[model samples]
Target: MFMFKNLKSDLPASIVVFFVALPLCLGIALASGAPLFSGLIAGIIGGIIVGGLSGSRVGVSGPAAGLAAIVLTAIGSLGGYENFLVAVVLGGIIQLVFGFLKAGIIGYYFPSSVIKGMLTGIGIIIILKQIPHFFGYDAEPEGADSFIEASGENTFSAIFNIFDNIAVGPTVVGLISLGILLLWSNVLVKKGKFFEVIQGPLVAVAVGIIFYVVTQTNDALAISPAHLVSVPVPDSFDSFLGQFSFPNFSAITNPAIWVTAFTIALVASLETLLCVEATDKLDPEKSVTPTNRELLAQGTGNIISGLIGGLPITQVIVRSSANIQSNAKTKMSAILHGFLLLISVILIPTLLNKIPLSVLAAILLIVGYKLAKPALFAKMYKLGWKQSIPFFVTVAGIVFTDLLVGIGLGLAVGIVVILLKSYQNSHFLHIEDNSNGKHKIKMSLAEEVTFFNKGAILKELDSLPRDTYLEFDVTKTRYLDYDIIEILEDFAFKAKERNIDIKLISKRGIVENPDSFIEFFKLRPKSKISLS
Candidate 1:
């Protein structure tokens, strides 16, 4: 119903999104070491089934590059792709349960710094991974996000290796495609609606296909099949149906299948939730997506995808952003894009296959640049070290390692920052010089004083001079940790030994010359004492 509401905007936006998602689906599948069709299947389902169910207007779902590493490893660990499909189905079920249980609240707890870091990190990874493809180096699989390649080369090494193995055909196509895309984005799109509707990536892809056709006779400019889009061609409708691989129902009982299922569910849900947050932020309309409903949609999509053969699905920021930039107005754009993938694969597989990977690489390069803009880094740095440290760490961790691991590392840093701030702001202390060689010290307990402030309080209490007047204020304190209470109780005795006068204050009444600080506090729970 929502899909048909904005046909004018959604139709053209869908075309742009289709161009962006086509290669990514195949690339993510290639990186995962699965049949290329699986990624397309996921894309189709994500666009149609999930898009139909999701409350999000612009969020796009597909086989994400973020899950490529997980899928690759899980496929091997589960003994085969068939068993992995069992896990995917089970994972979908688990996600459904999570949605029903209102587990989507977990997504809100991730710090903004870490989220921004993730975006920037993914952006950096995209740029790094696509560099080889841009140069016509096809050794590494497209959509591989890790720093180290499966071919035993690191990110920097892979970039350098591209220099030694450049193919003239792809190189020329990539450069031309990049130029056309840049020009289209900057100039042509601004001039008129016709140029805007044409979409740069679509033009780039069309040019790449034409370049491939023209270069067939010229060995010097001929692009290799390995460096071109490789969607499997089916001879008949029956053959196309055969491409879909069903899960091995027998594998459902296996513990390994369940474990893999849980892993997929957890990771896929997290990635989806994070993408939902990011997509909402990027939406010019600033429309809020219902997170629980999104989880339900993703769960249902994954279940159907696995049942009929497809990779795990998540809301993907790359595709969603492309949709937004293309001026997609509704979920119709996402649904249409999915249908386009399905129709194109069935009717025009040969045509689709002719597009060079280099052109797609150029398109991704622009996407990557947009995500990891230099301005973002400057902006984060200006937010100060508290925000910048976590942001930088997240980006570095994700770029140098895998997505989950990098996020974990960044979260660890973020938690530490939070703890340090909590410790610093837990309480307040003031010292003033009074007449007659005596100092007056006032300590105010925070609204909720915890054990973290114990050390600071103890240090201050220990540094007090003999014959000093100390005032401990807890009039506004609500919840005091037992450890802090004990510290104050112990300090009262020490103050007595130093010949300091004591003035105890509380909600009940002031207690001067209290026999025991512990008993005094126990008698009147909402109170503090001062020793002079």
Candidate 2:
């Protein structure tokens, strides 16, 4: 079976992913204004149910950071947590419809640069957001709002608050776990197979739990359950199964539920597609996933998660990248991690409660660091202005704003830079030496040349020497911008008297522009080009 063969290769990764998921499950719950157990449920469902069905080998699904804002808002707007749960169920059904309709193709429409910006932006947000957690600030949960903390203050104020109310016990645990993680990661893994077999996160979590057990029994250094994860324990099998939440079929008539449902469906799908793309790149084998199949799997997963009273789920990049870094070679690693979540809640509820939140925070702090490493910035800088500008803009925007908005700003900047370069260069503008006693000057417009490049191109054409055998070649250009065509048409009048030959070619046909070129080459109202 796939599970048996990949067990060894995936064990270390599953442990690392487990540590990563544990905090996230808790943090997303706190942020969403939902019961903490709901997030854990979602994580279990994502891993066991969704992960098992995924077309992607390495992508790890769970309650997503991107959806926290929506979840928080929806719960308030719907007037109750239960109402929001209804929306979650509806959302999953909508996603299933979207998958069957082949809407997953929309993922391909997003530009690679924009997607890269999104990942880098999220990376910076993770690092900046985790700073308070690293310093032992537990008042505001990890993955709190970029604009405000639980105290309703901005990022800087939150940082100050963390420093002011630093918890010594949690801080100590954080530091110890961080130390073990760092040492195991940088030193131990490279030294021998034995150390590599047991990942740093596994070692860190094991140590944290052991520390908890020892200290709790001694009374002098006991950590309370509040500082650890507190999943409710079921007294019996029936009670345990009863813990699962079911969809309210009565909610079917509520228009508000449908609206919230569609929103979650759209956002969750986008995030999953993005995470899947990023995960594939992170994989050591560099395999590509079928986007449509991923959509279907994610949709099915969300339906199951919602039916079980869990939060909305998506393919999360942090966990997925952690999976890849852990050397996961098959989807079995992801599925097994899900099983671990399921089993842990049932069998090790007490032990889970002893592991400190600060320790998990320290683990995430490191995960955040790996994602937004200083070397990543340096490498982007070395790639020159073209790459560096977008990369840093993405980082800065994310640090200052939320994830989607930050990526949108970075994408806008990237598009402007691309247009500026295109305007400054010539696509078809060229000078040739004709041996037959004629100076052949050729000018070409780029495929899908827009008005952005019009001014520079027109200027270049106006400055061309007179009495030259000018050949206007639009053969290779598709969808010439009307402004450019108008300029060319104006040139044609004067060129006619000056003996310039204008030859226009397109998918439509070759034709000379008459009086005003705007009428001749204007874009059809419905005509569109694929920019992605």
Task: Give the clashing residue pairs of candidate 2, or none.
Answer: 428-444
lDDT of 1 by residue, 1-532 (tens): 6557778788888887887799888878888888989999999999999999999989999998777778899899888888888888889999999999999888887888998898889888888888988888877765534553555676778788987899899999999999998999899988997886678888888899999999999999999898988888998989999989989988777898888889899999998998888788778998889999999999999999999889999998888987887788999899999999999999999998898988988988888888899999999999999999999999999888878788888889999998888778776888877846677777777777777777777887788889887677767777776777788778777788997665666575777656686675663554543322
lDDT (tens digit, per residue) of candidate 2 on 267-348: 8998888777767766779798888888888888888788778999999888887788778888878888888888988898
Which ten contiguous residues of candidate 2 have the minimum total lDDT?
523-532
**Each candidate: how many clashes?**
3, 1
In the predicted model 1, the residue pairs found to clash are 500-532, 501-532, 502-532
Q: What Cα-based lDDT does every candidate model obtain?
A: 0.85, 0.75
What TM-score would each prediction reach against the true structure? 0.93, 0.86
TM-score of 1: 0.93
